[model samples]
Target: MMLRQPCSWRMIIRTVTVIGLAIVTACASAPTRFYTLGTDAQPRITSSTASPSFRIEVRPVKVPTAVARSQLVVQINAAQVQVLEDDRWASSLPDEIRDALIARVNQQAGAPGAGTVAHGEDVPVYQIAVDVQRFESWPGSHVLIDVVWTVRTSADVETLTCHSAVREPVSDGYQALVGGHRRAIGVVAAQIAKVVRASAASATDSPLRFTGAAGKAAKGISCPHAADGAQAAADSAIAPLEE
Candidate 1:
């Protein structure tokens, strides 16, 4: 019987080192997944009958600093949060939100063009600014978004400020959580589209009517609910402020 000499200490150390390196390499090579708010699917909001004459320019969005990174930040508990390194946004959070809002608003409002004004063209431009006050993701529970948005034409004919808070229940996956946030954004877009459509109609009827601060105050437009398919059993509310 050949007695196997106890594995040499040097050999044991080398074997352990090689195993550790292999594990590290495997972990380092793990594929990262990226997500985007934009979707190719048909928009949920009902399209307007006439294409809007004015174009929409969605300004860059602002988000909380805690979730400003590319990685997905999720609330593990009331006091704890986790950042997933393997999952990231396709773009910065602000850019993602702005792009999503522009897409959904254009689709919902039936706007003719996006984010750009043709040189020397006499088309009205609606500038939409959004500030995200609270963006929370609770996986397997819900996703909440609190946003304050403002709409003003390039000519400054009228201004509308509104606040919207939407909370959507989600299932047990990251995809579902993202979907919930997408739907919440759609809800906000629907509210903004309502304002755009109304303003456009008013302008068509009387371009010079809503001109000064007094005229803007007299408009008294209330925030509207999410358009046809935009609301999905979500808790949402919109508060309009005359400006």
Candidate 2:
């Protein structure tokens, strides 16, 4: 005969408590929202007279360390920065920028864009590369982008290096900020297209040339406006992320 005691109430309470705590933790965690660079947002350019443009390939985009993470980074003040864990890019920021640039360039130039060139690719085409010097959004204010870009032909005829700044007004939200960033990037793409077209047609007397190795990856700088003023709180804290 064995004596059996009742179930241990303490053990039952401990298990119940653990399960309840887990449920509470799950409920408390914020949801993550993903975004893209709007690669397909622009209206496709259609023209019977569109010039034959050089084949274009974009190298991996280079972005500043501050914004190289998966999270969305915003400069709220001179000293403070916000990294929004809940809001992030669908792909790496650099990758997204490269894709967006290619789409925009293709639309304008009627030239198909190629993916990142792997080693030994050496495709006989024009390669456009961009290094993001600064990409920053001041919610309720503006989006600013500064990039150093180069265009070079696989034939090694011409190369162009230029630093361009683009600014767009935002309407008080991260969504608006992203839209503004897209617009700014589109502007840069257009500029690149113009140059590539000129180079391809052999229309210019002087071949475009720049110092340094073309398609060379480079490090990026801090937020363009981080030194301007007041820092906003983390985007997760300030913006309501949709489930």
Candidate 3:
């Protein structure tokens, strides 16, 4: 016959309890992954032509401090939940936005505008600088991009500024994150290009109108001949769109 010790039974129970807790904790933690999009490979352009009616230049985007700080998981708060993938941080964030904007601008510059052929000559009679104001991650795996762009006439010294934003959603998982980021960048790039193009049209339109009104005013003042210089100057003012 044998007698069971109370202390021995209690020790066995405690060991089993610790093992169960370890298993539960492991199951509770969500997996982490890392990912990257747009490799060291050179960027590609789908087209080589654009209009020549106006010139445009694009500047690199500047990121804010808050944005940089937010990229790390250790910094995320209750309101923010960063998605990690493939042993790497998520690529859908703004870490890659500036590059996207640069690519689009280059593509635009390489292509001819409405009035000229893209021959690698910088015809853009204007320069534009883009300042990124709000680029961040959104709820439900989405990203938001906002920027304020200032355009200056390279020929006349006129200036105008505009602002715009874009919100895009992501798909599930790491692979999806890369693809979603590409698509989102494309959308933002298109929006930025559109704004720049609009500004170009406006700048040309303003001077063109001034030229016309000046020509008419000269006729009324019996000084129509004096307007020839103005018209010629305006015509020459049109610069090649920079690629």
Reference-based TM-score of each model: 0.81, 0.69, 0.47
Candidate 3: clashing residue pairs, number: 29
RMSD of 3: 12.9
Off by over 4 Å in 2: 1-29, 46-53, 113-124, 203-243
Against the reference, the lDDT scores of all candidates come to: 0.76, 0.67, 0.47
- Candidate 1 segments whose C-alpha is farther than 4 A from its true place: 1-17, 44-52, 115-119, 208-217, 225-243
- What local lDDT score does residue 46 receive in model 3, on the 0 to 100 scale? 28
lDDT of 1 by residue, 61-82 (tens): 9999999999999999988899
- Per candidate, the number of residue pairs that clash is 0, 5, 29
List CA RMSD, all candidates. 6.2, 10.5, 12.9
- Per-residue lDDT tens digits for candidate 3, residues 1-243, read 899756787888999999999999987686655544343332333234444555555555566655543242211454665533314544533445655555554443343432443535554554656676765554337655566655454654434444556555765544554555444445544443443444455544454111222222111221112133223222322434334
Q: Write the per-residue lDDT of candidate 2 for residues 1-243, one digit (tens) a residue.
A: 999988899989999999999999998787888888865444344221343434678899999999998888887886778999888999999988998887877655557434433445533477887999998978888889989888776766545676678777889777887888877877777667655555555533444343334422122211223212111111212344332
Provide the global lDDT of candidate 3 against the true structure: 0.47
Per-residue lDDT of 149 in model 2: 83
What value of lDDT does candidate 1 attain over all alpha carbons? 0.76
lDDT of 2: 0.67
